[model samples]
Target chain A: MRKKILIVDDVDINRDLLRAILEEDYTVVEADNGKKALEIIYSMKEELAAVLLDLIMPEMDGFQVLEELNRRREIIGRVPVLIISGEASVEVENKCLELGISDFIGKPFNNMVVKKRVRNVVNFFDSKNLLEEKVAEQTAILREANITLKAQAEQLKKRNQEIIDLLGTVVEYRNLESGEHIQRVKGYTKILAECFMREYPEYSLTQDKINIIVSASALHDIGKITIPDSILQKPGKLTKDEYEYMKSHTTKGCELLDAIKSEWDEEYKKVSYEIIRHHHERYDGRGYPDGLSGEAIPIPAQLVSVADVYDALVNERCYKDAYSPDEAFKMITEGQCGVFSPKLMECFRKVRGDFEGLAAR
Target chain B: MNLKECYASIGADYESVFLRMGSDSVICKFLFRYFDRNEYNGLEKAICEKRWKDAFIYAHNMKGFALNMSLTRLAGASSVLCEALRNGQPEDGVSGMLADVKSAYVITEKAVGNLERE
Candidate 1:
């Protein structure tokens, strides 16, 4: 197809002269003034290859046309404009250049120079548009790659959680605890953490933090593996010294967890470490290992401590028969096993029925 | 005389016009007719009405046409007239420049008529 060139001049003779010169190689579209030229420029902006503009005209002048084109830079950016003026002073040419004209053609339109300049400017823009398309295509590809990388990372995270859950089950198997123990602990931690978040906004427990606490709750007794099988599986109660030695499981679990590292998320690892080391710590600062006081123990460990003790009371073990959910709830709230935070006791009271439901399962 | 002889006699560069216009006599005839019908009268009317901007437009148009046809002498006269009106020259000075343009237009018109006969 012939590339269209718009010839803008008020004088019919000037338009004809340009058309006669350019009409052979290009499709010449004529506008008698700047106003009409602007109309054509907008309507045929996509098809137009270049514009040959006269500096002086009725209604709107070349400068005005250039100003409007500058305002709509996208149009002028694609369609090159060459000023065709009888005025052709250096001042006028420089002014058009400042207005962002592609080229300048003096009147009496040199047959060769006009055609060549128009062709050159048009070719330059065509290549520029092609480069822009290529860049856009590459950007889209990069965006797709980024999305795939994000999905793969998400899949890897799910797999890592599975490995950690299996490892928790192994620890339970070795200690002669059922797989349901970990499940019950996780469920209880979630319920308590959620209630804590709602009842006390100061904790700032976002859903992500709750999820980490839940996952980390599974490994709270991971240190129990370090205790001797004689103590872990003993049918009778431990002697005072033996009980004191068994209490070191909290700190021993922290050391075992700290020794090994993997590619798991750092926040999850940190929550796991806190739960392992301080889940036995009492709210009144009387607990073993750290003897951390109220609010001094990390909230994750505090919540896990409640879940661990409640599960142990409501579920059967070698040393004790299982207590009813009501009896277990009363014992924990009445400070039968250890002193817990008042706020946690409130949350536990609210979800006591839910805990009973889990016990039934 | 033939169009070429007539063009040469009046100092119009006929060969350049022939080459530039692709030897299309119809386009040549149209341009000549346009020049004859309007060139002098348009400037005369603008000057008579004291429309200096209109006068500059007409004079500039004439200069462009004359330059395209390689009528350098007429183009030079029209360009001078255009510049005078453009710079807001005194009425007497503009009138003198307009006279020079009119004299050149008359000679160019006669030559165009002679070529049209061929």
Candidate 2:
């Protein structure tokens, strides 16, 4: 259907003239006074394409109608208005334009200029409306995609946790140590690492890193799988050659880790590798497969080393009887089991009660 | 008299009006409709009653209606009267300006009559 056009003039002939010009291309609607024009404008707001308003009418003039339209922003913005008036003074034109009429046509109306201007205003508004609709649509689609991505990231984290637990089970079965050992070690590591983060801001450790450190501690003994059963489970001290073989477990554990093409996070695998290979490192280059000394050892490896030694001392191992928590704390603090970073020893001092608390559980 | 002579007699721009209207038939149709409403009488009544705002509106509408019909001489006369009554306060020489609009209206109406008879 042809778009509707409203011609408003109190004089019958003025409305008739515009109708004659526009009626061929549009569905012409006429209102002889301003009040009647507004009634038509409001009623046909959606269907009316343009309103040709006259400035002088009995009840409400064109300016009054324009002011009303201005208040109804949704209606005015969508529909174009072209003022047809003999009052072509700049002041009148400026006032109407400020009120948001799209264009002004002065009398005598040029048949072509009127047609061209009305068509121009109508086309411009249509394009603006279309662009706004497209932007709204795209925003909604992006919102949906963001929600889906958040849910996927949560699921991936959960799946990675399950895999870490499964690997710890394999180590428990092979090494024949109490499965509780790794769990307690994880608890102690997390407690000490949190305290370390507070007292040693130089490390810049976050809670996210602490979580990875504790979980990676579970696989610190994974290389015990490669040690001969007689050696790993011996109930007495080993000879010098056997001790050398036992030390190889750290490097072997990393080899086992490197053998598989894992699909989990690279950061997770990197933390696990550090824990497996260097948890035996000493502050004086006296411990471990690589003998990485001082702060040269990764912070993750240093943290798990303290957890591993404390858990071993308090838990009965194949080669030693369980010591009391106080005895284990003294051995670690006094450098009896291994030499650790002094900075770490300070954190361990603060978490002494925390470690004993987990041991009791 | 033919339509062109009739329009010329009133000192209106008949050729451009015909060209702008795009069709002689359309112009003639509006020409007859022009007499359908006479705001000049309303303007005169408003002045006599001292309804200044009403008088100004009547003159403003008269100017627009005359211009739309290509009666520039009438539109110009009415425009002068419109400005005098614009603020709705009585001004000096407004009656003389009103007289000028009346003469233009007379000539315009006479031309319409002649065209109707032709």
Candidate 3:
């Protein structure tokens, strides 16, 4: 399609001369003065390819028109302006160039020069717009690819968690503990961690922290895999030396996890390491392995400690019958198995009914 | 005399005008006639009223038209009158420039009439 050009001149003969020169290659629009030209520019901004503007006019002159165009940033770059003036001087040309005109054509129009400059500028803007469109298209494609990559990473992460849980159950089966033991511990940790997040803003137990604690709970007893079968599966209470061998499970579990020769998310690895190494640490600095006191224990491990003891007490094992949820809860609260943080005990008290419901199920 | 002789007598470049307008005598005649009907009367009224700005506008417009038509004498005289009015020259100096413009316009008109008769 032929592009549109606006001819702005106060004199009919001048406008006619420019129209005669340009109308062959373009659709010409005429305005008698700057004010009328501005009106046309406003209404036909998108259609116009260039403006052939005369400097001297009544109402608003060429300089005023250029100023208006400069003020409207959206219109200025989009439409190229060619100044046609009788008073063409170096000063006028410089001023128009500073105002961002595309080209200048003096009065007594040259047929060839006007046509060529107008065509050249219009084609230049056309190519510029095409480049911008291509860039926008490429950006959208990159954004789509980034979203797909994130989803695939999430899928790979879920697959990795499944493999880790399968390895954990292998260790549970060797000790004659039900696979449900890990599942119940994960569930109870989530309950306690979520309650703490809601009731105590200072604990900063965000949802991400709760997820890590739950995932890490399944690996808390992973060290038992390295303990001798005789010690792990004995039908009676452990001897002192056997208990010492049993206590090595915490440190050994950390070693086993550290020994895994594969890449993983650093956050998951850190959370799992904390839970496996410190879940047995006592709140009062008396429990085995590290005797970590109060907040010295990582919050993830502390949460898992309460969950592991509660699940162990309420679930059946090869060595003992399952205690009722009420008995398990009393033991944990009364500090029978080990002393827990008072804040964690408070969270446990709020969700003890939910725990009984899960055990019953 | 022919239009060329009359144009030469008035110090106008008839050959260049003919060439620039693509030898279109009808267009040349039309523009000269348009100026006679529209611009000349407005310029006379403006000069009579001593409205220098209005007189300058008329003179500037006539200067551009005369230049395009290759009427060098008329274009040059109008340009002088335009500058004199624009620069706020004394009344006697502006009137003298206006007289030169008027004489040039009369010669240009007679030259156009000669072309029309041909």
Best by the lDDT measure: 2
Task: Choose 1 or 3, whichever is better by DockQ.
Answer: 1
Question: Which segments of model 2 are wrong by more than 4 Å?
Answer: A8-12, A30-77, A131-139, A172-180, A192-210, A225-235, A259-262, A294-296, A310-361, B47-54, B84-99
Candidate 2 residue-wise lDDT, B41-60, digit = tens: 88889988989999998888
Q: Report the Cα lDDT for residue B97, model 2.
A: 87
Write one digit per residue (lDDT tens) for candidate 1, span A1-361.
9889999988787787778778988899999988999999999998998899888776898999999999998987788889987777899999999999989887555576777788889899889877988999999999999999999988876866775686697687885467788889999999889989999998899998898789878988888887888888788999998898789888888788777666667777788889988998999999978899899999999999999998999888988899988899889999989899998889989888887888788
Stretches of candidate 3 above 4 Å error?
A140-361, B1-7, B14-22, B25-30, B50-53, B85-92, B116-118
lDDT of each residue in A1-361, candidate 2, tens digit only = 7889999988777777778778878899999888888789888887988889988777888999999988899888888999999889999999999999999998878887788888888788778877878988999999999999989988887767766777789899875556898888899899989999999998999999899889888999898889998898888999999999999999999999888675787888899999999999988898988888998999999998999899989988878899999999999999998799999999999999999999999
Tens digit of per-residue lDDT, candidate 1, span B3-116: 677677778777776665556464466557676675789888889898888888788888877877777678899998888788544345788888888888888777666664
Score residue A166 of candidate 1 by CA lDDT: 68
User: Which 10 consecutive positions of candidate 1 chain A have the poorest summed lDDT?
Assistant: A106-115
Model 3 TM-score on a 0 to 1 scale: 0.63
TM of each candidate vs. truth: 0.64, 0.80, 0.63
User: What's the CA error at residue A126 for candidate 1, in Å?
Assistant: 1.4
Q: lDDT ranking from best to worst?
A: 2, 1, 3
Cα lDDT tens digits, model 3, A193-244, are 9999998899777997788778778888888888888988888899999999
Candidate 3 C-alpha error for residue A179, in Å: 16
Between prediction 2 and prediction 3, the one with superior lDDT is 2
List iRMS for all predictions.
2.3, 1.5, 2.3
Better of 1 and 3 by lDDT: 1
